[model samples]
Target: MKVDVQLLKDICEAPGAPGFENPVRKLIIEQIKDHVDEYSIDNMGNLIAIKKGTKNPDGKKVMVAAHMDEIGFLVSHIDDKGFIRFQTLGGFDPKTLTAQRVIIHGKEDVIGVMGSKPIHVMKPEERNKPSKIDEYFIDCGMSKEELEKKIEIGDPITRERELIEMGECVNCKSIDNRVSVYILIEALKNIKSPAFDFYGVFTVQEEVGIRGANVSAHSINPDFGIALDTTIAYDLPGAQAHEQVTALGAGTAVKIMDAMTICDSRMVKFLKKTADSHQIKWQPEILAAGGTDTSGVQRMGKNGSIAGAISIPTRHLHQVIEMAHKDDIVGSIELLIAALEEIDTASWEY
Candidate 1:
């Protein structure tokens, strides 16, 4: 199956902070508006779509989720000298904020550069430790009057990096979960006849917390649930081999557990079986740190649903530039299709 390169670029490049997911949601809606049986945007900013099944007219409800939010900052305080101080919307590695370019979504979009004290002027003790995010300021190259006229407090800020194609990988901001959004949209377009009624939910606020998925899952209350997201690929230097979690190009990750929840063992087994039967590249994931929407979906309603996650191996997560391999991206969609095609025979009760 071929992945849509342009769509992937559009999703990754779109600005969608935790509570500001409209831009990304609009793009997703445009792509799958006609493909699904029905779809709607919830009050919590989730795009929930349903695709009916022909094989089992009375089958169970199967829910698939992918979050659309990206880590960013919100303008909190602006100094009289035109320096913009902001608060983080999601998790960030403070070290990565230095020297990065960002766009402030205010009355109008304004480009800004993160500024900090020059290293040459820093004290020996200061240079030894990493600078905190609060210590850095955004420079819009505008005077106090010009900045006050256009920008205001509470505006959202997003990374301004464009998607770049490496030899076999793609690098851009917000790859943490946009890659999965691409996967879900592509899988929905490709999977012609699923075995069970599918509720594909494009969620929000995943980076801040699994709030959107929690509300949507309680509302849908599906029998089976799956969270499509990206996992840490610490295959770079300085990371120990045993703690790599996952590797780039190692294939789609069958998440066993993460910092949030332990995936349903039955679902885990079924996914492995499907991947093997179809000869798809796969790996087991145990995220030592961090979580996903899988946690909220697994324990939503009365009896709860059997839940698991499919993760794309990613490098430099929560940074200005995150990376994912093309093979892993395509492999994730292939595995999702294969699993959905065999959902009837696959047991979820363990």
Candidate 2:
């Protein structure tokens, strides 16, 4: 599909914890500032960019949200032996933290290893039980005084990993929304003439809550919206087919509903029709749990928006090695661009 692997890699690897989105926001602005008609960063760190439409006489606006923040942690305490305790910023499974690497952002970037009780010491009952978040600590291999020189309290900590392609899929740490960020950037570059004024927003703190999207939507008050994010692809060795919400390498996903929002009926139909018309491969997404920035983009605006999402099928979501099919990634960009261009032709009337 001729995907830009390097660009996606850079975006995915950049560190941007919830409420600490500076690094990602800078990278996004560098990639998209000139491509859009106008761009600005809001107080909450959402990067809002716009491109004027060709045929919008009513000044309709379509807001596209792609959250830039990844689930991360904040340093809460540093012990006498240089071990660090942290408070989580987003949902994190404790099992994923054992033996994983993390980068603590203080005066300088300090690498630390996640440490927990050794399996050799665990009792039979404890051996099978899942670890809790409080059981983990960061080991920096330094003394209290030495670690204190380079570290500080409340610094953001992010998972350490690099993006790589594995046959037909790409795997990385922040593929959840960074992949969507890359899609939005590429969509902006490829869009020739949007049907309505395009408001592409790289939202911040979404990993914590829908803070950035909430504020941005209220200000833009868009008539229509499309959120770009990753959805769970549980197509593993499970025995049941219905349990697999989506599948890797299948295609892009058109939103029906998630734990947070039910996509507007018209928007859902429009996305399906657009994909069918363009021959863009797609699958239906009905996530049983977890939500995206769709909640804010759909309802936080003044009059609310006819909003839905174009989801990339992702595997191992929220873990260190999240994966997404290259074909689904490519198809998501195509579907988003097609949806933006053809939005005006849809019968939005309820």
Candidate 3:
């Protein structure tokens, strides 16, 4: 099946910054409710959808996690002149915020721009330094009285960028994890006759930490776990060969390890074998820094789980113009479905 770019666009465009994941959570529920046997939102705002396994007599569960949240900001204060001070909800490169547009989700959605000092007035020494996060503020372009009517402190703010098709990829804000969200939804709908029951969890607070995945995985305690997320594709120019984590159009990533967790070896081998048997293109991922929901899924269970991850190779990650290849996106979905169907065939003994 081909990629559904429209559905992916809708998923990426929906704002759900860290703890403020209500909007995108709702969108995921709408798309998957009818496809799953059952689905529910947890107390911590994770959306869990379950599909019963047709072939399992052992009552095994496979938990697949895809975080629903994105890196964003929260209003901290509104200045007397209508400039707004904010705190970021997740990691951000300060320079990427320069003059970027954002949406403030308060009493109503209000648009603002990241305001910073113009280089024309900067001291010669200042112009050479990288921008600092604290040096920026939001410009609402409205009077303080008018701004107060629609915005206030603690309201969530999100990057403003629409998904667009590049030559061979999709570019948009929140592609870091939103592309994984799209993959999980498609896999849930497409997988038939899985080897074990599947718990498709669209998690929250992952951009902050794996908080939502930790809670949900603790509750599910599955026999197998796979975290679907994006990893850096430093395949761009001016990079050494060893430094490229993965590349656009390279294929779906089979996680070896990241800073937070070393993936279960058995699960890693199973993913690779399954992909080869199915002839799905694949790559190995070793993120030197950063992590995904894999950490929580691997250790939060009662006995811990045989966990790994399927990472989509993405460039300009955590930035507004994050990008991923459509081919890699489709490869991820294929590999996930193949794994669920063939899990019973793999040797799980370590």
Candidate 4:
């Protein structure tokens, strides 16, 4: 069955920067309340929703996590010309900063455009050199005095890109984990099998670090964990075959290793077997850089528990135009449900 594109769009468009995820948290709670047995928000802003199984209450615990935070900017300084100087809350390519519009969240909403020195107005040496994020400023079309009336330091800023349909794929900002979040929600809605008690965690502050997951994992102490996230798809021109981590439209990605976590092999095999039995499309991923909440959950308690990740192949991650295939998302949800249904607690060790 097809997932609702409008729901995905709404989740992606919601503004939830690191350390500020109330808006997104509320949206998720509303969507999954009926499907879960219990739900609560931790002190660090992680939203945890539980789905109990028919088995014993002391049965195995399974946690599925997706982060709700997106990469954005924070107001650092405002200049005399009403220009806003900012510091990045996460990683950004300086090349992508020119001429982009941003929403500055102050006491009130303020729209601004990223401003940089035009090449025509720059020196010959400067024209050939690439720009740095520090060289950029946001113009809000107000005087310094007037700007103070609206915006202030520590205000959040987000990319001003709208979700759009391109051919068969959907593109928007924050699709990295939002798409994964949607997958988990859809899976929980359709699950009807006997399995361990499940916890769907929508974590915060992931773009800055896996801060929320670290705390949530400790609270749940799950016996098994799966982090739903997005992985890079370097399938564009000039990228080599080996460098292409995964490709869009191929299938859902099962990550073996990334920079932070080495996935549990038994859990990986179990997911793969379930996908095969259910005829779900899937791919294997080995990310060279970056990590996800899997790392935190894998080492939460004494010696921790089995942990792995199911990732969607995404193009232009951390950018305004992130892309993912519709079929891959469906496949991810199917695979997750199948695994949950077929997982044998007696076979697993610790």
Candidate 5:
């Protein structure tokens, strides 16, 4: 069965920066309420939804996590000319910050553009140097008095990009994780077989430091854990084959290691076997730079638990135009469902 592209689009386009995930949290709750057997929110805003197993209560508990927050900006100070100075909530490449449109969430929605000194007006020395984020400001086209009337010091700003389909792929902001969240939801909808009790967690504040996952893991203490997220695909120009990470259209990525955690080898092998037996497409991934919720869940319990990651290969992550193939997204959903269907306490070594 095909994944719902429109639903993925909706989730990616929603605004939910770290520490400000209420809107996206509500959207996810609305979508999964009818399908999940049980659901609730923890103190840290992690949304945990469960589908009970058909087997006896002795079955193992499996936790699947996907972060719901996106990289965005927080308003720092509004200058006299109504230009807004901001701080980034997550990692950002300063090279991508010029002339981009952003939505400043205030008393009312206000649209703005990132303003910088034009090349013609800059000194020759500045032309060769990359611009720092602090060097740019947002222009809302309002007077200083008018700006203070609506926006404040802590308002959030998100990239303004509508979801768009390009060939067989989809592109938009926040697909880095929102797409993975959609995959988890879709898999829950498609699974019909008996398996271990499953808890799908939509975690918050991951971009800030995996804060929600740390708390949620301690609460659940599952026997097995899997983090569904996106991995960078450097298959573009100037990228070498070894450094490509994972390629687009190469199927869902089964991560071996990232900066945060090294996946349990046994769990990795089990997932790979399950995918192969079920005819699900997959690729091996090793991310050199970043981490995910996997780290927190892996080391949370007494002696900890087995952990792994399933990733969608994405290009231009944390940007307004992140891209992922539809086929890879579908493959990830299928593989996740297959793994959950066959999960058992005996399969876990620890």
Candidate 6:
């Protein structure tokens, strides 16, 4: 099955930093509203979509979560020279911040360039060390008075980059989670009669923590949950063999364990079995660090629901030029659709 490249590009390009996901949420709702039976946004801004099963409306409830937020920054202080100092909202490699273009969401969308001192004038010790994030500032080419009039503290800041095709892979900012959101929407459009009542949740504030998933899972209390997100693929030139958590073009990753949760054994087996039956490529993911919405859903509800994840293998995760293979994206959608169709609570093992 061919993935929708256009939709993927749209989601990746949209701005939806943590705690500020209205732009991406609106786009998702517009695409999925016609396909679902009912949909609404939660108090925490999670877009909850319900697609009823043809067999039973009260059938097993299955929740599929894909966060809409991305790593970004917030304006903390604007100095006299119109240089903006920002507080990082999510984890960032200080190395990636220097010389990058950003969009500041203030009174109006303003373009700014991240700047730092030239290495030519740096001390020997300073040149050998990585630059601190605080040492950098954003230059909007405006005076202090002009900048203060259009911008204010607490405005969101995001890396500015459009999606680009790189051979078989695509590169852009926000691909970490937006790719999974694209997968979920595509699966919902293609799947026919599912065995369970499906809830496609576009969660918010996942970049900061799994806050949105935590709340939605508690309210839905799904029988089974699958969190869709991206896992870091260290298949690079310098990384060692054992350090490679996943590889680019390796297909969808079926989560075994991460820092957050150990996948339910039954869910793992089911996903592998489904992939084999459909001839969809897959891999086992054992992430050393990092967490996803899966942890939140697995521990939610009265008895806790069986939970797992289908992750897209991404290279240079959280960077402005994040990359994901197109084939792996399609594989994730195929595996998810197949698993949803076969979600039979009676047949699932304890």
- Show the colliding residue pairs in model 3: none
92-153, model 1: which lDDT tens digit per residue?
A: 98899888899998888999999888999999999999988879899999987899788788
What are the TM-scores, per candidate, against the unseen true structure?
0.98, 0.99, 0.99, 0.96, 0.97, 0.97
lDDT-wise, the better of 2 and 3 is 3
lDDT of 2 by residue, 40-84 (tens): 989888999999999899999999999999999999999878899
Q: Rate the local accuracy (lDDT) of all candidates.
A: 0.91, 0.93, 0.94, 0.87, 0.89, 0.91
lDDT of 2 at 176: 84
Decide which is better by TM-score, 3 or 6. Answer: 3
Candidate 1 least-lDDT 10 residues: 341-350
Model 2: how far is 38 from its true place, Å?
A: 0.5
Models sorted by TM-score, best on top: 3, 2, 1, 6, 5, 4
**Candidate 2 structure, TM-score to reference:** 0.99
Q: Evaluate model 1: give its TM-score.
A: 0.98
Q: Cα deviation of 299 in candidate 6 (Å)?
A: 0.8
Where in model 2 is the C-alpha error above 4 Å? Answer: none
Misplaced by over 4 Å in model 4 are 56-58
User: Which candidate achieves the best lDDT against the true structure?
Assistant: 3
Q: Name every residue pair that clashes in candidate 6.
A: none
lDDT by residue for model 4 (12-101), tens: 988888987887788888899898788998888899988886664668888889999889999999987889999998888887879988
Clashes of each: 0, 0, 0, 0, 0, 0
Q: Indicate the TM-score of model 3.
A: 0.99
Report model 6's TM-score to 2 decimal places.
0.97
